[model samples]
Target: MASDLLIAQPDEGPVLDLAGDLSLVLPSDFPRIVKPFAIEAHSRMLWSELKQPLTPWLLMLGFEDVDPKPPWLLPGLRDLQALLWLAEQLDHKINSSGDGVVTVVLPPATQALAMLQLARQGPELLDSLWDPLLTWWTETRRKLSHFDRMLRLQLPAADALRPPEVWRRRLQTLSTCLNNPAHSELVLALIGDAARWPVLRRRCALMPLNSLPLSRIVLQGQGWTMIPLSDSGLPILITARDGLDQRDAIRQWWGSASTPPPSVHWGRGDQQGRLTLTCRVFAPGVEKADLRITCRDQKLEISALEQRLHIPLPEECHGFTPLSARVKGVCIEIEFR
Candidate 1:
């Protein structure tokens, strides 16, 4: 897995925080001196480019090996040699580390520039770095969006030392610093603020309301409450009242929505080695109706008693052909090769 580091340029200097679990695979005799120098250089280089006092940056680094016995063209070989000579110029001792064939988690942006500086170097180096960095940047933005929405919706208590205005200003500062904020230091600071603000703290105490209900079991809380999943599998908010039988409250809440939803399960492989998908529809008023099942455009459709269900086939099920479809009891079984 690629390792991630968040670099925040505070007044003192750039602070590097590990975004995820840090498992660095260094050479057995890794040159400790070079690592710090590379980090310092990269940090300074990035900070200068951003030109902001407190900006946030993210870096992802991973190692991979190109195909063995690669066709090392004359230019490619020269670029490889230039990399080694550059290392030597830093007065750093070089050692035969690992297979020497595998790409190391070298410095991120700077290393890419260094390699791409070679006019005739293969495009593999830039490609390997660009793709992962792009993907990581996108995913990081998504996480920041979720966090920003949460912070904005839940305001701090008025009694806190740092008022809502202060938080708002801080958030604004962060927003100015990062077009899309996911800075580790800022995120941690906001979390710490949550602990200090009573109202925000209470609001941040989220319960696990997104659990699947098994069998006929229903969750009963301080009030008569149940959490049911929506059609898209997102958790619906709980509705409850004090001093009520949970089951009775559930039935009242269910009301028109009490009809059991159709469920599809995978059965064992048949003698012909084809997998079977069995859907059970035991809703009231639909038992006597004829069930028609069909698949089109990678979507499975089932219709009965004026009700229709559409299920998207997972990626693993793609290219699978439906061999047969039959109804037995409440189940509509479909075999796929």
Candidate 2:
């Protein structure tokens, strides 16, 4: 069974910030309780879903041009560094100023980070800061949960990431690079494997393995519209919560669920100046379809799938020759090259 995506909301958790306030400490009125959080980033355990592949059905959440890194994928290193840096600055001020004062305003994430740091040392010398530090810890935890729980709850969105099950079986086959999920990045490893698929390889060539683009299907007044994130004109890989594949027909199929365009397989002839072009035909608004092949000097029709259209080329050409056709109002090029 395919697993549904769980995209994290934007307004969920606050990000940590430490700048001029690094030298500031909470006043006496602040909270005095603190909770525990691991200093290490548990990527696999906490953000397990992010390890999934960049499939057509998945949506990438972070790295948006306008947004910060999503909270779920948030690592403690930054927050911990911000808290420790502020602590160091405050310590220096306490030593130098004789009678020092600091800013009292900060977000809960910072307050939680401060409480963790304030518990480290100099309790006797920093007794004045204790009240605010502990109080902030208690208050912050009241909303964001204790440290471990806080990390657990901060999940990143999966709108641009496909579930692992989508390729689990194929990955287990040991024939492709995906044979080992840990071999490399999920997207890059899949791209390495896509080198074997002519259609997918063509799409993969549009972007580097590390730079997978994202697309979305947004709802208009009544119908849904697919908007591509890239302006490069490469095929947009649409993965949305709603709408059928037919709804976004104008978009080039670039993702896992994308269909291969109609194609033909040329069979070897028996020295009779006759070769068979086996065609797999998919067309617009028809249950059954045929191919209309044309070259500079001749044209022919292939009406059957596996057993049809025994015809000769203008000069028995070798290599791929570009042939054009129209299907479902879209111009489809039949050459696999």
Candidate 3:
């Protein structure tokens, strides 16, 4: 998200000084109705959702016009780096950070809040000092205090003694950068392949792989399921176990196989310039009641009650537009022309 820098700083006295101390004052009617899964894991769901809004707000106040790189690019770069690391774990040749680590490059929440506090307290000093501090760290990865002292040596007596309190606050804010999570730790948490790394089991939380911008490509007859991690479109393959498809294995492990899998088939329709596709619905009452079909780019996503299927459209169907889709008996017929 793009944010405009605050031209005239707010005169409000002593805003929240730390990220942990900040709490969003949401309306009383917030989340009036909750989904079943969110209701069961309310705290986790809230944390996941709140992070989206909170991060942007803190970033606006802290970095604003000072960031050399756009803040939004930080997350995408982290995701891409994590993807390369995942490819490496799957025995694919993908380079990531040289050291096989993907660090969160964005400022941590606590540090961002402190920077905002400091910016409000003394925006004047930051214009001259912040860039050099960032440049020194990027080159030498040295402590900020080292930069602080080195800078103080060159400063004239009168300029350096302007405000003792402001100097102290600057050091405190810059110090929080040291508290950022380790690169390896953050990447491992995102990949979530605990089976390969026993150390990951010790961690309390793991990000769901599906949430990342990744796509699973099954290699038929090769006994492997390839997950494409980058825009290169080449697949990073993982050997399948016990002759079971990776998704089927997941379903069995999760004990959610009550619903029969949807069967799909496509062929040339009765009319010339038309294609017809059909999917068998096991539970007509459930699937037909609140069914939704969405086609975007080259993929079709069908969702109903407790089942979802994502099917990639054939190359031949690219130019054909969707004409009609309807449920009949225990089957859904979708026509394109």
Local accuracy of candidate 1 as per-residue lDDT tens digits, 1-337: 1211111111222222122112343234422222222333443443343333222221112212222232344544433433433333222221323221111222332233334234122233333534565566566656666665776533222122121232233333323322221221111111112123332222111111101111121222233222322231222223232444344444443232222233455554645565544433222212333456778898777665444656677666678766666655434566666
Report lDDT per candidate.
0.34, 0.30, 0.34
**Model 3: how far is 138 from its true place, Å?**
10
**Residue range with the least summed lDDT across 10 consecutive positions in model 3:** 1-10
Per-residue alpha-carbon lDDT of model 3 for 1-337, expressed as tens digits? 0000011111211211121212233233432211111122333433344354344434534643322222234433322222222222222111222222121222342333333234323324333544565455345433444754876422222222222343334433332322222211111111234243232211211111111111121122232233323221222223333454354333232232122223456766556554554433222223244467788878766665434556678887876666666766434566766
Clashes of each: 0, 18, 0
How far in Å is the alpha carbon of 330 misplaced in model 1?
3.4
lDDT of 2 by residue, 224-265 (tens): 243322322233333433444333332223232323232233
lDDT of 3 at 209: 12
Worst 10 residues of 2 by lDDT: 1-10
In terms of TM-score, how similar is model 1 to the real structure?
Answer: 0.22
- TM-scores, one per candidate: 0.22, 0.17, 0.23
Please state the error at residue 213 of candidate 2 in Å.
18
- Global Cα lDDT for candidate 1: 0.34
